[model samples]
Target: MSWEEMLTTVQESLITYWDGLVGSLPKLGAALFLIFLTWGAVTLARAFIRKLGSKTRMRKNLTDVLSMLAGTGLWLMGTLIALAIVFPSITPGKALTTLGLGSVAIGFAFKDTFENFLAGILILLREPFAIGDHVECDDIEGQIEEITIRDTHVRQTDGQLVVVPNHLLFQNPVTVRTNRDLRRTTIICGVAYGENVDDARSVIEAAVREVDSVRNDVKDVQVFAQEFAASSINFEVTWWTGSQPLDIRTSRDQVVAAVKRALDDAGIEIPFPYRTLTFNEPIPVREQGAQDEAA
Candidate 1:
């Protein structure tokens, strides 16, 4: 209970604190070093995969997928190594068990995204349609611009790019318009009831032939008397053109314009709808009565 006793107690406490700090220095340094190495390795792995992706012969979507998958795998491996080095007691088996148990919860939370991811993989592997192919899925129609693990990129005919989930692509019917080398178009024209059907057919066929953008791969340039329409005789002009959907649209416009000019030159009157209105008589307005005003 004196000054010397107090001094002795303070010395003992300082010695214990210093020993504890010295003992913990190695563990702290090891953890820090492992974390730094893991970060550097992950960065390097992504850079390498990005370079590889650029050189790949795969489609743009597939290339992106490969790069992402490779980068993720390398980062995961680096994380596992770093964790094991820093905390040796945490075994890989325990980590796997924990992740497996947690996956069930995560699966439900990300069900839609996971389905989209799986669907994207199927689309890429099956090669249903490649980039630049025009596809109609559900009510959306556009050209395939890019594919991803979760979504598909499309450039619409109107020059807009849309991002659609892959699940939607798989769940709905996809119509690819430009798969074949040629595309056929049907253009119907109506002429007066008494016009020469054979002569009109010949004129229409010649008009179709004059279109330079039209393809010759069609079975035949047929002008059929399809129907006796309400006002005139319907002549069907069917032809083919090997062009992209946008180009097909332009080509169709050209063909239609040419056919219209030819029909005008041939004196074929394309009549409009007719309606007749009949009136019995006009109703006369009655003058107001003075007696009614009084009431």
Candidate 2:
């Protein structure tokens, strides 16, 4: 074709395409408006869920989890709405396929974390131990301070805070000392062998009773004649105290002090270990030269 004819044809084609684009501008604006509405709705729903979660009976961990899930749901919904508005041809099946492919890698990356998360959730639901309860697990003894979605925080007796993964906690044997109404503590005391055992036992029992914090429901303070030691008579004084954080330590100190005072008053001695050594007079050793000269 001639150059002039080709130029005229290109101009007509451009004019027609521009007219079609102008016609669709209103539809595009409406689609954008719909996307904005969907976003606002999702945001409102997330806010409402967060508010309700804080006020509900759910535990702190569960509340956090639920709020996260609600927010994620809103995000996913808003994403889908925007996708539908902008690209009506794309289907959810493609999104599912993409997610399935990514899920395997994500699982491997967070395997331990996922296990702890589930374990924490189960623990929160079951509530085997509450905050401030003394517990022993796998030879690690501590008081629980908080239960989180991935770990349980325990304050050790030595004042160190430990973060234990919930999965291991579930698998191991956990001994909760203060789960009941009262926990017992035993302070073993011994007196001099010459002291009367019955009198010593009575004194220890009275000391246990005098501690105002000690529980009365305890099956009597037992002062058993545990053993006959070389220096002192051993007696076991086991008594119960109310379930308080430091009740065991408090009761123990009180009982030990009282017992010492009582024994001192009665002239019963808490004897320390003693050893008596006797040495025979040795023959005088002579020097080699002196011995030789004497011979």
Residue-wise lDDT of candidate 1 within 142-196, one digit each (tens)? 9998887889999998999899999999988899887876788888898887788
lDDT of 1 at 9: 94
**Which runs of model 1 end up more than 4 angstroms from their true locations?**
1-56, 77-91, 125-127, 159-161, 217-219, 267-295
lDDT (C-alpha) at residue 275 in model 1: 63
Query: Which ten-residue region of model 1 has the weakest summed lDDT?
Result: 77-86
Worst 10 residues of 2 by lDDT: 78-87
Query: lDDT per residue, candidate 2, 152-195, as tens digits?
Result: 99999889999999998888989998889787778778898887
The best candidate in terms of TM-score = 1
CA deviation > 4 Å runs, candidate 2: 1-58, 77-94, 130-147, 151-171, 174-181, 193-196, 217-220, 242-245, 274-295
Error of 1 at 131 (Å): 3.9
